[model samples]
Target: MSDASRHLDARSWKALRDKSPEEVADFSTHLSQPCEVCEAFLERSDEDDAFGVESLADEALGSMSTPREDAVGWARLRRRLWTPRRAWLAGAVAVAAAAVVAIAVLPPVASKEHEDRSWRLKGVAPMSLELSAVARLPDGTLHAVTEDDLLPPEAVVLVRYRASEVSDAMLVLESPEGPAQMLGGYTLEAGTHDLKEAGELAGVSLAGEHGPRVLVLAAWPRGPRSAAARDAALTQRLVPEEAAQARLRLRVEPGYVAP
Candidate 1:
C-alpha cells in the first residue's frame, strides 16, 4: 500500500474509469490503495519471510539427489517451525473468531423497516416502445413520461401502467380528431397508505390481451402532449355519449387500495 492510494477517493477512481478504455487500462496499472490492517499484516509477513525461504530450501534439500546432511538439516527446521499448536492458532485468527459464534447462532429476519413505500406497477406487462423514455425527478421522486420530440408521425403509441405512491393519479384518452380528453379518478396503494388524488394522464389506444379489443386511459407518458390535450383525450374516451361515441370508450378504475 502507498500514501497516494490512501489519498485517492472513490469518486476519483470512478472518474478515472470513465476515461477512454485505453487510458483506464493504463491508469489502473499505476493505481495504488492501502488497507491499514492488511498493510500491517503484509509488513509482518515480510519480516516472517525467513521461514518461507527456509521451508523452500528444505524442500530443495529433500530431493533424491541431495546429500544426506542437507536433507536432515532442513527436515529438522520444518518440524520446529510448523508445529500443530501454531497451525491451530493461525486457523483461529483466519476464522475471525469474534464473529464466528454470532454468525453461527443468529437467524435472518425480514422487517418492515427494510421495505420501500413507493408505488410499484406490480405485474404490468412492459411495452416494446422503440422510443421508450424514463426519468427520475429530483427530491428522490421518479417520473417516467414519454418523449416524442424526435419521433416520426408514423410512430405508434405504446401503453404501460405507471404506478407510484409519490405521485398523483392521472389518465388520458385520445379522440379521433387528435385531441386528448380526461378520464375519471383513480386510487393506488403506497405500501400501507391509500393514495386517492386527481389522476394525471396520457393517451393510450391499444388492444388488450383478449379479443374483445379494448382501449383505455393508461397511467403512462403522453409523449410531449400538453395537459389540455391529455384532459380532452380522456374526456372523449371516458365520457363519450351514445350519439357521439368515439372509436373506443374507456372506463378508468382505481386498481387497488392500500391498507
Candidate 2:
C-alpha cells in the first residue's frame, strides 16, 4: 500500500473529509503504519466507499466559502470519482489522491531498497481493475506474491485481482524486443492463475533468456483489443483483438526468475 492508504482509516477519513482539501496535507505525515482498518475500508463493496467519499466531497464543496477549485485537488477528485463507468474510483482514487494530498507539501523523500519490495503491501493495484504479481511455491500452491517477496529459482509468475469483482482481465509481458501477449482475451474468475496455465505456453517462459521481466495486467470493461477505459493510457491500443484494457505494471526481478 502507498504511505497514504496505510494510515487513513474511517475516523481519519471523516476527519480529513470534514476539513478543506488544503487541510488534508496536515494529516499526511502521520500515515505510516500497517493499517487493516483502512484495508477493510477499501475492501468494502465498491458502492459503500464511493457513496461515502462522494457524500463527503459534496459536503466539502458546499461548505467552502472559497472558490471550489481553489479548495485544492479535492474538488477535481470529486468530479473524477463520480464519473460514470469508473468502477475503481473508490479504493484507488480515494487512497491515492488522499495520500498525495497528505504528502504534497512535504520535503523531498528518500528511497530505500525495502520500499521496492513492499509495494505489494498496499493491497491495492494502480489500475481501474486490480493486478498483482503472483507466484507458485515448490509445493505447487499459489500465492499473491510480489516481486519484493522471495521466490524460488523455478517459481512461475502469475496474476490475479484484488477482488473477484474486477473483471475482463488481460495480461501482456513487455520484452526488450516488444510486448508478448500472455492472456489477452480472457477474464479472471477467481484467485491466483499461473500465466502459463491460463494461456498458451508455447515458447513463453518468463524464465527464458529474457532474464527478468515486467508483467502488465489489465482489468477493465474492455477486452484485449478494444477501448473501454476513459483513460487513454489504460486503453491498450497496441493490442486490438478482444475488448478494451486498463493496465497495472509489475516487475519480476531478474535474479528471482533466473535459471
Candidate 3:
C-alpha cells in the first residue's frame, strides 16, 4: 500500500467517528477509487456500527476530568471496537455504554501504581467477548499489557475474560513451533472473571525467548467433549469452526525495557 493509502486506512475510523467535512471528503474520494481493502473496511465498520460506539466513547471521554483519563478511556474504547476482526454490534454498543458510565463515575487516582494496574482491554472477538492481560513488573507494580506493549522477561501474566453467555473455553499459546495449551476443558461463566482469583488456574509466565506470541481463546457452547476430543480439535484447528475466538498478539523484542 502507498503512504496515502495507509493513512486512509488508519484514519478511516476517525473520519467516520468525527464526521468532519474534510475527513469525510477525503474518505469518500478514496472510496471512489477501486480499492478493495478500503471498501471492505468500510463495510466491516458499518456492520460493527462503528459510529454508535464512537459516539459513546466521545461522550465518555467528554466526562473525564483530565487529558490522561481521556487518553486512557479512548485507548480502551478503540481496542474494544476496532481491534476485533469480527464483532456483533449490539453487544459492542452495550459494552461501550457501560464503559461510558464507568468512566464517568470513577474517581481519578493520583498514584502511578493504581493507575498502571487499571484493567486494560487487550483483545476482542466475536460474540461480544474480550480478553485482558496484566503483567506484574519487576518493581512489583501491575501493568496492563497491550498488543504493542513489550512484556518484561519472565513476567507473570494474569488474565481476565468477559463473555456474553456461559461457554466452554480453551486458552492456547501459538508460537512458531505449534499451539501449546494454556488452559483447556474449562467452563467460562457469563460475565467477567479473573482466572487466578477464581482459583481455576494460577497464571502463565511468558518465556524470556524473544519473538511474537499469540494468545488464543476459543469458546463454544456447553457440550459433551472429552479432554482427548478437545486436544484433537485444537490440534487440527487452533480456532474451532463456528466458534467464537479471541486472539491477542504480543511481541517480545530483545533488550527492550518497559517504561
Candidate 4:
C-alpha cells in the first residue's frame, strides 16, 4: 500500500478505474485507513468527472455533422465515458448519441477561424511529447484554448500533456518580461495527464500577465537524474540527448474578453 499521508498517483487511479483487481483492493484498503487527503482527492475526482462529461457532451453536440466527424467526436466521447467506473454515464452517452445522430443530417458548419496551434518540437527521441492548454471557467467548466485565442485576465489555465513513454518531466514557463519559471516536476507514465491533477500546483494563473508566453515540457527517461540536476538542465535550456520536449506558445491580452 502507498503511504497513508500521500494521495494516490495517476497510475494507481488509472488502474483502479480500469478495474484491476489488485489496484481496487489496494485502494479500498487505503480508503479504510484515516487519510483525509486521499478522501478529498476522491471527491475532487468525482467532481472533475462530472464537469468533464458535461463539457464533452457540449463538444460532441457542436462538432458532429458528417460521418467522419461524427465518428471522431463519438470516439473521443466514448473514450471518456466508457471507463469502468463511469458506467453511470451510459444514460448520458445515449443522450449524446441521440443528439449527435439528429445533428448528422444537418449541413456541416464551416471550420472555426482558429487553426490548431499546438505542435511538437521536430526531433528524434525515444519518447514524443505534446502540449495543450485549457481554461477553467468561473463556473468550473473547461474551455480548450489555442494559440489564436486571447485568454481572459482571470482565466485559470490548466496545462495538459501527452507522452509516448514513461519519463521524468518538468513544466517551465517563459515570459517576455521574466526568466523561465519552473512550474513543477512530474513523472509521466506514458499517457495524457492534466498537470493540475497530477502535481501539487493547482493551476497556472495568467491574471497579471500579458504578451506571448511559452510553456515548455522537457522530459527524459525516468530514474537517471536527481531533481536538482533536472532543474539545472532546464535553467540552461538543455536536456539529455535522448529527452523528448514540446512547447506551447500562448498570448495573454488582459483587456480581451473570452466568449
Candidate 5:
C-alpha cells in the first residue's frame, strides 16, 4: 500500500484509491473509491498487464511488414507503460461496492421524495404559488386552511405575502357594519411582508359571534388615490372581473376564522 492510502479518512471516500497489491485479492470488499480504486488496482496487476501487452504486441507485429528502427529504449518503455486493455472487471467490482454503501447510508428515506427534502416537522407542499402566500401557526409551522381547515380561538395567525412587482397594496377585511375595513395600507415593492396579528383585521377584537370572513389583498399603481376613493373602490366586492377592468395588479383573498 502507498503511504497515502493507509492513513486516509474513511469519512471522505473520495480520497481513497486502490494502490496495494493485496487489495486486488479482495477487490470486492475493499473500501476504496470506485473510480480511483479500480484504475489503481488494474494498473498494479502484473499478470493481467503482461498478458495485455503480449496480445497488443502480437497485433502490432502482425500488422507491420517490418519492425520500425529504434536506436534508444524510449519506444520500448513507452509501449510497456501505456496500453489500452479495458479494465471492465475492476470497474464492475467498484460499482457494486458503491451501490452497497449508498444503500446502507440512505436506505430508509431513499424511496420517499418528500421526506428526503423536508424539514423535521412534516411539511405541506401547496405553497408553490406564483405570488406565494402562506399562513403560519403559533408554533411556527405553516398552517394551511380551507373551509375544512379549522383554527383555534386564540391561535395567532401570520398572513404572509411575497409581492412580484412594485405597486400599492392593502389588506382589507369586511367590518361588522358591512363596509370595507382596511387593515393595512402600504407602498410595497417586490419583496415579502409578514402580518402577524390577524383579528377582524381592523384592530377590532374578534371574540364575538362573527362568522368566517375573507380578507382581500389589493395591489394597484403607486400614484395618488384619496381615502374616499380608496374606500369607495375597496368597499365594493373585489371580484376577478372588477379587478380586471380597473387594470389592477394582484388581488389575493386569503380567508380566516374569528371563532
Candidate 6:
C-alpha cells in the first residue's frame, strides 16, 4: 500500500485498545493507517495497566513520520502478540520494504525499457482497429509517397491520416549494422535484412495489423539518379532488405527501401 493510502495517528491506536472486541474488529477492518501497533496492543488485551502500553504508544506516535524501518518496531510489537515466532522478525521486514520498493519504483523502469525498445528498424504492425487507414496506393506509387511535412519530426510515415499526422509509429532495428543511414528518397543502399535480424531490434504494432508488419526504413527524393546520387546510392546500396519493411504507407520517401 502507498503512504497516500492511509493515515493512522496516536488517537486512532488508543481508541482501538480502549474499544470493545467488536469495535476493535471494526477499527482493524476500517483502518487505512498503519495497523500493526494498534493490533499489537489489542493482542495484549489486558488494558488495565496502562504503564507499558502508554509508553509504547507515545514512542510509536512520535515515530509515525520516521523511516519505515523504525516504524517496523511497532509493527513487530503488534505481530508478537499473535504469532510468537522468533525467527521471522528480520525476514518479514525485508519483505515489506522490498514490496514497497517494487510497487513504487519497478514500474517506471520497466516502462522506460519498453519504450526505448520500441524504436528501431523493424516495421510497424497493426495492434488495433482504432487506427484507420487514410490512404492506400499501388506498390509502384508506394515508393513515391509524399513527405507529410505537418507530422512530427520523428514520424517517418503516416498510416491513414492526411498528409501530416501525429504518429504513434515505433521502430526497432536488428542487423549487426546500426540504423540504416538515411541516404535520401525511396532509394536505399543495397544490403540484406530479415525478420530475424530486424525483429530482434524491436517490434511495432499498428492499430489494425494483427501479426508482424513490414516497414520502409529509407527512401530518396525523386530526381535523376545523378541529382540525388549519394543519398540514392546509400538508400539503394547500404540499407538492408531486412532493415526496412514496406508494410505500411510512408508519408515521406524513407530514402532507403527494401530490395
Candidate with best lDDT: 4
User: Which segments of model 5 are wrong by more than 4 Å?
Assistant: 1-142, 146-148, 175-178, 195-209, 224-259
lDDT of 1: 0.30
**Distance from true position, residue 235, model 3, in Å?**
5.8
Put down candidate 4 lDDT per residue, 1-259, tens digits, no spaces: 4545446666667676677887777778877777877766655664335226457777899878754436457646744753221111111111211111000011112233312311222222455677666665555455676654677656666656676766667777778787776665677767765553222323566656778876677776454453554566666654433345676667878666667
Clashes (backbone N, CA, C under 3 Å), per candidate, total 19, 12, 0, 0, 1, 46
Tell me the spans in candidate 4 whose CA falls farther than 4 Å from its real position.
1-125, 196-202, 226-228, 234-242
The CA lDDT of each predicted structure is: 0.30, 0.39, 0.53, 0.56, 0.34, 0.29
Candidate 3 residues lying further than 4 Å off, grouped into runs, are 1-126, 177-183, 196-201, 224-231, 234-237
Question: Which residue segments of model 6 deviate by more than 4 Å?
Answer: 1-174, 177-216, 226-236, 239-259
Estimate the lDDT of model 5.
0.34
Give the local distance difference test score of model 2: 0.39
Candidate 1 local Cα displacement, residue 34, angstroms: 99
Q: Is candidate 4 or candidate 5 better by lDDT?
A: 4
User: lDDT (0-100) at residue 27 of candidate 4?
Assistant: 74
lDDT-superior candidate, 1 or 5: 5
Ranking by lDDT: 4, 3, 2, 5, 1, 6
With candidate 5 superimposed using the best TM-score fit, by how many Å does residue 155's alpha carbon deviate from the native? 2.4
Poorest 10 consecutive residues by lDDT, candidate 4 = 99-108
User: Regarding TM-score, does 1 or 6 come out ahead?
Assistant: 1
TM-score of 1: 0.16
Query: What's model 6's overall lDDT?
Result: 0.29
Writing each residue's lDDT as its tens digit, candidate 1 over 1-259 gives 2233432234434444456464455445544344564345444543334236447767888874845556456545644653321111111111111111100111112234423522222222322111121111223222232321222211122223323322223334453444443434343332322112222112232212112222332332222322333344355454322111112232222221111
Question: Which candidate order results from sorting by TM-score in descending order?
Answer: 4, 3, 2, 5, 1, 6
lDDT of 2 by residue, 1-259 (tens): 2245345566556656577454366455443444676556655724335337657877999888765435346546634652221111111111211111010111112234434532112222223334444444346454455443545444554443342333454556655565554434354544433222223221122343233444555444423322233123234334322222333333444454322
TM-score for every candidate vs. truth? 0.16, 0.31, 0.45, 0.46, 0.31, 0.13
Worst 10 residues of 6 by lDDT: 99-108
